[model samples]
Target: MTKTHEGYFFEDYRVGQVVRHAVPRTVGAGERALYHALYPARHALYSSDSFAQACGLSAAPLDDLIAFHTVFGKTVPDISLNARANLGYAEGRWLAPVWPGDTLTASSEVIGLKQNSNAQTGVVWVRTTGRNQRDEAVLSYVRWVMVRKRNPEAAAPEPVVPELSDAVDPRDLVVPAGLDFGSYDFDLAGEPHRLGDYAVGETIDHVDGVTVEEAEHMMATRLWQNTAKVHFDATQREDGRRLIYGGHVISMARALSFNGLANAQMIVGLNGGAHASPCFAGDTIRAWSEVLDRAETGAPGVGAIRLRLVATKERGGGLRGADGKYLPHVLLDLDYWALMPI
Candidate 1:
């Protein structure tokens, strides 16, 4: 028997299958330090214990993306090891705050599959949930990836594309327990623009940029323990360049948004997102956001803001071209909801 693990292919997946991913991670202050070093993340709720306590959290919780990336990393070996691309995401929600010393485990349920016309690859959809040591779900999301077929001639499974929501309803957004923004410090939080200050249809260019570096991107991927082949194996692509991980772009864009949206803290819901274009090292990434809507949350003095965050290679580029296809300069299109002061 060969001791090597070759990983799963598109044909290996079936609807209704459940996969418990390996390598649970215990995240602590170290992950937070590294995350701040890797990205320009400076949200006060995540950056300061005193600030978070004032806002009613037990303490400064790990950055939401820290929880996200750690959990998503655990699924890569089983979900996207042989993937050609990670397509998109939808209906994601952060269920609970991930405190320091929390151990996270992940599992995925295969829900949808569709073979490609070329028969060389197929798309597989999975709903993944991340839980803490107490078995409380910390995060949940649906993602699809295009995986290569080990045997192109294999018989195709019946296509079962899931009917996913276009966006997460604001009422369903989870507010961390004890989360009160009544005492939120606008000065320490870095911006005074409260939820009421933002109008629907308004756009804000973050007005900053970061040049993606090969080493930093790889380090971030390794930190998350994401073992996707295309992100690490140069030979995986004919172009001979390691593709920057999509989550890396997401963190960078979210960090950059701080300049203008500093108080839009605690991401609670991810409505939808796309890796609109492949990003590589040396690309200068810029971010912009549009306020899509606002809603009152039941949390004390807290409100929810819906945002369309766009990341682009160029400083200010249009999202779609005339044909409604993503422009080449666009790198990511993320729709999400965050908690802010009323």
Candidate 2:
């Protein structure tokens, strides 16, 4: 028997199947250093231990996306190795802070699947949870991907589409234990705007753009341990262009939003997100955010703000066109809830 292990294809998944991903990672200050180097991330809660302590966390935890990318990388071989595209995300929540020296592992359950009419591709939906060494869940989310089939003639499985919510419920959000914003420092946080300063229906333009560098994208993907061929091998696509990983775009946009949303410290919920268009090297990424909603939380001196964060290659393009599809310039549209000082 051959020792080489090939990745799974469309027909390899079934509803209710559980996959325990391999290679748990221990995250620490090094990941934070690399993250700041990779993106212009300067959120004070993640930058200083004292600021986090003043906010009631024992220490500054890792950036939320660090935990996301690490866990996501673990599921790639099992869920998206042969994928044509990672379609969308929904119902994501950070259950607890991933402190320094915490080891994380991931597992996924196949919840839904449907074959495409083209017969060469199918969509697989899975709910993945990332846990610490103590087996306490730190993050959870649902994502669907389009995977290619090994044989076009193979029979299709019964379609089972999961009923997902449009957004995460505000009442269901989990605030990290001991997290209190009562003593938050606006001067140190870099923004004076509190949760009350932002109004529903208000939009803020984050007036900065970063052009994508081929080397940086590759390094970022490799840092996540993602080995998807399309991200590194040009021969995988007919256009001879490498598709920048969507997570890269998300991080870039989130970092850019720091100018206007510096106090939106912790991302507690990811209601939904879509990769509106594929990004390639040399694209200049710009971002904007619109306040969607607000809610009160039991956490002392903390409130929740729902936001629609949009990333685009160019400025001034409306999110949708007359046909009700995303404009060509749009790269990513994400909806999430964050904690801010009240």
Candidate 3:
């Protein structure tokens, strides 16, 4: 009898399978402290209790990416333990604020599956939901990964690709209750830009960069409890180097955006995101954002803005080339809607 556990492979998933991930985490101030220490995150709503209260929150909530990384960590053992790459994300939404002392768990349902033509790997799409202890869903998103097959000769499963939206509908964005930014303090927020100050088709070069370090990247991944081997095990890849988690790049880019978008406080919806290239320890990440659209919400002093946030190793390289593929320097391309003071 054997009592060891390996992980799922390409041939092991079905279109309707559901996986309830284990090891629920209780997040609080400690997570917030470590996150700030790891990255140059200075978002006001996530930094000070008083600042959050002034904006109508009970207190400062954890950084939205902290919630995302914590929840994403729990799903690693089940969904991506043997993944070759985490491809993309879609239809993500932050439904509620995750406060200190909140316990979070995650579950995922396999919504789409397609075996690659090479037969050695396949794409598995899952809709994952992270819920707080009270059974209230705090976050939800669809992510797909490429998984290696345990048996290369296994027959391919029937392909069932999901129909995903190109972008989140602004009307579907959820604004936190009592999040009134009408009396927002421009000085405190560090940027004078407001909801009305930004126009559609405008672009902002954040004009900053941070070089990722091996120690910091590893520490950040471990802080989130992400146990994927490629991020930590140098032997897993051909070059004998650790791969930085894609989420790390995303958070780094978001933190850099604070220079020009300090008031884009809460990320309410994640329409789409693609990790265009692999980031190593020494890559210096820079960010830029283009205002896609804006809308008024029913909540007083709250509005939504859709923006495309791009992370690149070098500046001034267009996101896409003439061939319609991502440029070599582009590391990440994310589209989302965030709440700002009107």
C-alpha local distance difference test of each model: 0.95, 0.95, 0.94
For model 3 the local lDDT of residue 231 reads 98
Error of 2 at 72 (Å): 0.4
Instruction: Give me the runs in candidate 3 sitting further than 4 Å from their true place.
Output: none
lDDT of 1 by residue, 127-185 (tens): 99999999999999999999999999999999999999999999999999999998878
Clashes of each: 0, 0, 0
**Candidate ranking (lDDT, best to worst):** 1, 2, 3
Query: What overall lDDT, based on C-alpha atoms, would model 2 receive against the true structure?
Result: 0.95
Indicate the TM-score of model 3.
0.99
Prediction RMSDs, each to the true structure: 0.6, 0.7, 0.8
